[model samples]
Target: MPITLADKLVVAISSRALFDFEEENRLFERSDAATYLQLQRERLEVPAQRGIAFSLVQKLLAFNTPQMQRVEVVILSRNDPVSGLRVFHSAEAAGIALQRGVFTQGRPPFGYLRPLGAHLFLSANADDVTEALGLGYPAAHVYTDSVQASLAHPNELRIAFDGDAVLFSDEAERIYQAEGLEAFQRHETDRHGQPLPDGPFKPLLAALHRLQQIADAVPGMRIRTALVTARSAPAHKRAIQTLMSWDIAVDEAMFLGGLSKGPFLKEFEPDFFFDDQTGHVHNAAQHVPAGHVRSGFASAMVETTATIRKHQDQG
Candidate 1:
């Protein structure tokens, strides 16, 4: 078969995002999320091998037999220990336990393909990944979906994210955490009419927005998006305003309040869910793909995994 363009989807993930979550927390808080992850991947001298999501990304890439294949991993850091390290190294190491020859032989299905330079190709850098594909990749380029269901065929690639701290400014979150309910509500009410500043997820959102623009212009361009948030009504208003300010289109938005969000998530289904709180992530993981984003906040960083785990267990 001629290598048809319809048989593959590309998921770009940072080394840290794919690595072990337990140990990375300390570093995640001390620095920026990307910096923390990049450092973790470099210092550990190993790719992240813990989470189910990491394993799934590897499976999609290595198992090229099926029509739904994936090619993931790209180095985006400018300066770091693992900056120059091979992107495939992480994949190979993680694959060793599964199939010995898989990583070493550079298996036909999934192996280290080649380098995608910053401007030339998306390098897993949120900004770069989004910008490069804004024009639209011949392949489907999605950020937030975990199941990769969005790309049912090899053609479409999907991306997913957890709302709140991931896409919008964590400022509102900070208020909620520090000030408690009344203060948090008051602050949100005060800021109701105004849009929140772009949070860490902005770079990616901008990239998706650009892609949406192109998709709008061109026919048969397969690009999609969703905003799965824990924010409820009234609180959800800011998210809408923020996106409006940026002029980004979210194909779907789920404002899940105190309600068990997992059911809704499973129904909407995403490639991934990025949330700052483990409480939400734990439940969401059971249904759909999920990733935890450490706010790089002191309180969150200070909390031990045991504690977070315990809290989740309790919930």
Candidate 2:
């Protein structure tokens, strides 16, 4: 018999994304590999603090019972093997039950996502995120300074996402960017029944949906998702229709009409939130663990690499 990841919701995350390694990471940034490894070795027994994605990972792992394991979280990091010890230690201290990881030292770690069957990839390193996204994985550049995971909901995993450019294609966004609100509204209104194209996080959403299915039979664990978008009124029809079309359902949806998403996200208290726009992300990060989906048309407006936007339609 052989081990396999098929039929499981697997999340491949970075060491920095899973724990607060900023201080140690700073040491690595300023010094050589030996110095970084030595520092990690010195503090091998000391558990690291929880990073932004900690709560999310912890909750997802809870879906796995003694008899049935529905989720897997693997540490896919750039740290040398010596530095990997603290990561497992930190997970143990947090009671995360994570047992799988791939340590690439300084080499690119995105290549491992394929073999790991990753549904999502969260890394503090933007380059790895970009690479994973390029390789067609749903990857996010976790904003380390964002709001830490909320302790309000321990058993339930709360995840939020932006609609346009985050969950769905930037087609409507392109119109909104090119024309005025009226044109955008009319376009969506005309296409209310039509399903919008899938975005980068759609695959991740589908994977979460599958986990949610498992949670239904499990007693102690649950999954809550929200579509917190800036689109409001008639435009909301298309977003809803798209999810419905895909047979995916979210616990909640906020159509804020181009307003700030911070307060709404605060109320939702997600373990993590994802958005493609900078302003929206910054606002949400102030209230919840946030990640930037470095894809879509809005990202193109920021003068970033066009390659990310070119492959933006992928998940």
Query: What are the Cα lDDT values of the candidates?
Result: 0.50, 0.90
lDDT of 1 by residue, 279-298 (tens): 67667767766655544342
Error of 2 at 266 (Å): 0.4
Q: How far is candidate 1 from the true structure (C-alpha RMSD, Å)?
A: 12.0
Per-residue lDDT, model 1, residue 240, is 84
lDDT by residue for model 2 (51-170), tens: 999888888888888998888899999988888988999899889998899999889999999999899999999888878877888999999999897898888999999988778988
Instruction: Kindly give the number of clashing pairs for every candidate.
Output: 17, 0
- The C-alpha TM-scores of every prediction are 0.53, 0.94
Which regions in candidate 2 have their CA more than 4 angstroms from the true location?
Answer: 305-315
Q: Which ten residues in a row have the lowest lDDT in candidate 2?
A: 302-311
Native-to-model Cα distance after best TM-score fit, residue 202 in candidate 1, in Å: 1.1
The C-alpha stretches of model 1 lying farther than 4 A from their native spots are 1-158, 216-221, 296-315
